[model samples]
Target chain A: MTRIGRRGAGLMAAAGLVAVVGVTVVRPQFSAAEAERPAQVSVDEVEELERAEQILIQRCIERAGFQYMIVPRFVDPVPFTFSYVVDDAGWADKHGYGAALRRRAEAKVDPNERYFRSLPPTRQEALATALNGPEPVGLTATLPGGQVVQHSDKGCQSEAQRELYGDLPTWYASTKVIQNLKGHRFGMVLGDPRYQAALPAWSECMRDRGYRFTSPDAARSEKLTQVVELRQAGAEARCAISTGLGALVRELDTSYDAQLREEHQSLLATRVDLQRRALPKARAL
Target chain B: MRFMKKAVAAGAILVAAMGGAVVSPTSASAAVTAPPPDGHLYAWLDINAGEYYHCRWVGNDDNWTNCTDWDGVARNMHDRASSVQNRGYTKEVNLYNDAGQRGAWRCLSRGEFWPDLRNVRFNRGSSETGYNYPMENRISSHLWVSSC
Candidate 1:
């Protein structure tokens, strides 16, 4: 998984690639069984929708009298796709923060310098406005903790989203609500009584293997040599499985997702519709 | 049982993928800063001496010397955050040099890490509003807003 920089507001994801195999090897839960597979949504659907949105964005550019080439930039960092979950141990271990994945993929990016250079500054500005929206007009959403994030959505991405979800402001607020909840969801699962009951045993298992952290996250946070992190990560993954953290977190995540779907039904319904809408477009493509 | 087998197999594939991809080595430490559990905003700060901290939340601190680690990034969190990891889902976070969202600032989209924000400045907004020089350790207060 590679994430394109969300820069210049108007520019699309222009660089990055994920091996098809990466998806198969992602998320321990999904990889293991076709039968006992817990409830989850396919990121594949999301990716397809993203591609569909790009088609509309390109049309927007053409209408503006500028040539727009489809830039199939992958936005999620390597080893996994999206920011939703980290059930994929391979991705989790290799990407930790997913920064390296971006670093590796960025070197291959070409911001269509040739096309942009062909235009004068005035036209360039127009192109940016056409692709993104008017500059200096951005939106801000404050988190529960009161930290505020200001972002520009005047671009093709924003346009695509609006076309799908109806309006920007309401969609933005609704989505942020779920996102803020997301920040706490995983921590909640790991801290749950069921998950907590397995902690001591998991810690013991790690300690027996010469690791000291009581929690998997702590062990993963250690800044060891890549080799050491990799080696320890393997043991940690096994420990998680043996100690039941793996099974428990997956179950909790699925339950939480279901609960969220019900709690935020209207907004989530819009999202589900967005995914379904992408399938026909995908087939046509 | 079959699921566990599949997970183990996936793990093997990952180990193989990571086998030859060697990253630069850092000194060993018992210190562990688990990334903030998924879903919240986070940034990675690396100090001058190769010491790095993966931080979850940063608050309003007027001065670095006046800060503490547990809540923000410890005291002296002022001008030392050389890098940042933006794991945000929707918003673009602005990194300012000075407290209360003052001084030179830079905005990063979600899932971006400026291994170095030392000399970076604000984009998207007018260039006239941002500092012309590189801003290191000058970030004071920041808020997540609609655009940077």
Candidate 2:
């Protein structure tokens, strides 16, 4: 072989070696960077919570006296109609730690502010819908019993509905559904109208746990303590409802989450083009 | 051998006259360009986020299992990545969650870009076949994200 041919072969090999080394080093770096970047929104849980909250809130709103909207993520609503009702009924409120709304309402908050103030969470949606919108309502009038009643002009439920669903008389309903496909048992219930209804009686129960209504018979107090006991029972029932809902919700979306997971993995499996526009700007640090 | 030498000499002369270029610059550049890594962004499933937690709780009786406590989620994710890498694929993974006091989970993967990839999944720790932790202790979608 000529000397030039051997030299040419050696030079070619050296160039190939440099190219391979450079490519190997550069490729992994790019791949690694691409691999680490995360998606903008991981929102499956948020969506699910919102769905569940919507269901419960709708159910609660449809009932007569609970004539109030949930303050998503807020501890309680301003002027707290529920609290005022409880205070008027004179039941002591109590809640576990966390947001201020977790506390029970004592004093009669102004009917106008009732829609705006914080109070104990009964339907238990304050945490779930926190990210969405704020509370929407205002107070109207003070009742003769010192309870501040939200006025009809304020767009709350009418007096008759409140009477039927609230202080007057109310019935609780519970529904149980066993998922056919997944064999999961879930239950939803309106155990206590106070938790589910905006009834003045329910609110009055919140204030004085032992407060009672004097029947026109005048000698007999309609034992408001029964309402407190009812509330405690309702809390227990709601807990069960939450658990059942959890199982059923999981079953309903199994394939969907699976698909999302697959889509995510596929995204991880392919090559990415880091366009100049998409590249992150280098931080000064 | 003499004919081969003559042919080689002729090729060399032609190459020298043509600036010794064996391939067009465009073709050479194209041949050397390495494929980019998959850049599709994937965020780690934020269990705190409503969608992920709801998916995990959909059917199983236990509503209280927390995805964050399940470190196996991360391990499973890494293992899945190994399978893909073994199959001659490229990727990146990351962890993410909503704003809260609890530390974010590490098992989920997020990517920047991806193409020709279809699906990737891993066990997120909760199982229909097995018992999960206590429900009373379990975090719910109704709980504040920060509490997680």
Highest TM-score scorer: 1
- Cα lDDT tens digits, model 1, A36-147, are 5323337786677667777877777787788877766544444321222233457547754454565565444334434754677567556655554542123444434333
Winning candidate number (lDDT): 1
Whole-model alpha-carbon lDDT for candidate 1: 0.49
Per-model TM-score versus the true fold: 0.49, 0.17
Model 1, runs deviating above 4 Å: A1-48, A62-67, A73-130, A135-153, A179-181, A273-285, B1-148
Task: Output the lDDT of residue A195, model 1.
Answer: 68
Report fnat, model 1: 0.00
Candidate 2, residues A1-285: lDDT per residue as tens digits?
254467569668756766887776666766686568563222543333333444443444445233344333322322322211122111222421112333223132333225322433332223112211111112122211121111111111222223222321111000000001111111111122222343233324323434332211111112225444445434322332333432333332454444434544433222112111111110100
Please report, as a residue range, the 10-residue window in candidate 2 chain A with the lowest summed lDDT.
Answer: A171-180
